[model samples]
Target: MKMSDVAKLANVSPATVSRVLSNPDLVSKETREKVMEVINKVNYKPHIVARQFRTKETKIILVVVPDITSAFFSRVLRGIEHVAVKNGYQVILGDTENDTDRELEYINLLLQKQADGMVLLTARQDKEKLEEIAEHFPMVLACEYMDGSNVPTVSIDNISSARKVTEHLIQQGHTKIAHITGPINVVLGRDRLRGFQQAMMSHDLEIDSAYIQEGDFTFESGYNQMLKLLALEAPPTAVFAFNDEMGMGAIKAVKDSNLLVPNDVAIVGFDNIKMASVIEPNLTTIDQPKYEIGKKAMELLLNLINGEALQKKRFVMKDELIVRESSELVKNMP
Candidate 1:
């Protein structure tokens, strides 16, 4: 159906209908609702390419994620999709596949005016580069963020969440704790590591240098790191991993070595992925608002795109610590 037909049926001018469809905020609230009702009733679809030629907007959003296979990013993507669809927009998935070059290629799409806006799930770009991009396009960061840039971000307090989980293990009287970290180059890895370290120091616990293992946020890396830590003269009584994938890997390694969970060695993880709750012994992990972060990031980006001012650029979400059998001692059972 044509937009003119929609305008006639809705009792508004074609220009008003165009404004309602392309940028709802520009129209009056009553007019927007009436136009949308007519739109839904007629199922009229605009020719996006023609619209783009006239408005310089594709009505498509570019969502860039570092890894496609990771469940953590997938959850965030779901949230982003929900908001995009409701706002008459399409989302293009840009999987970086952990390659910086590939990531930059997706960003360049924005520079080329293929996408109206962008939501960066993983912020690996240099501060200057990200600033340059944000200056020219509407952008928001999710999960990961820039170090000192003004780019809006939606994420939890990684350090506090990590420290709180570590403190849980310490409160249970487990010392000699080992840490399995994400790649130290990123903020997620660095903040989680600092949280673990700070928690250990707060309790006057001996921070074992040999117990720190760096993982690439993968199961294999977690398994391998756990093996290395197990080989130490005195292995840790508990292990904290930056993510659930690594935590599960550590559990497998411990079981392989004939060690009991929470008895021989307790395990804790961040990011309460689905597997975290389904494992043999449910994982004790931090529940980050992955879905909410994605939803908010898109909202912020849309506001920027619609020329609305954002009162707050940075949104720090809250996290909950879930305790389960993975980190619970049988003796301490109620």
Candidate 2:
């Protein structure tokens, strides 16, 4: 049966009928029960496609990620789905493959009316474009946030977390430490690098240019950068990679060079993924609340969708350091 038919039988306005079906919370319990009763009797199910033509909303939330295959992102997506499904919304994932063009293509779902709102995990678009779209849409940033924007975001304090991890190594008596960082252009990469620098400075350790390596947040980059560090005349006893993939790569590189992890070279990584513990020496890294970040970002987006005001535009979650076999407090392991 049609929505109009359901409204006529329920003796309610078409808007009321739509609210009861699409967003039951917006309708009072009395009105909702009455409409649902008529809807059940008539077996009314509005054609979702046809309904979107009038309301300009598809009741779908688009989630964009850099790499869908990465297990790190999988956890976050799970959290987003949990809340979206519970709130009567659907989630569509878009893999940008680290391409800005691909990201923009999926973002068109908003203007094309294929989705109601968007949640971005890693934003690669221009600030001007994002600012323009976010001004009139329900959007939230997760994991990676934009600089100089009012868009709501949920993420761990990358700078402080990185500093804490680096300090952990220093406390273990590592005087010459090295770092493998993600692309410095992105916010995550830059903030993490800054944290490492600050930690060295706090301990009055000399910041050696030879110890810093730039990585693209990939396994290959991690392996290659670590090889360079291992070849140095004065190699570091401790190394920190931006993510676990890179950290694992570094561990492999050290092993390939006939060196032992946490013995010849202690290593630390970020994002304590499943592999962190499964590795030979295990990994000592920072654990970001990936799932919680996803949940909170989606929750914030839904609030914006429902026209709710936010007291804080940014939500900072807690990040903890998970110490394992990779970064033990043994200095000069022979």
Per-model CA lDDT versus the true structure: 0.91, 0.91
**How good is model 1 by TM-score?**
0.88
Residue 100, candidate 1: C-alpha displacement in angstroms: 1.2
- Cα displacement (angstroms), candidate 1, residue 241, comes to 0.7
Model 2 lDDT on a 0 to 1 scale: 0.91
Q: Clashing pairs in model 1? A: none
Residues 243-317, candidate 2: write the lDDT tens digits: 999999999999999988888899999999999999989999999998999999999999999999999888999
TM per candidate comes to 0.88, 0.89
TM-score result, candidate 2: 0.89
Candidate 1, which segments miss by more than 4 Å at Cα? 1-45, 330-334
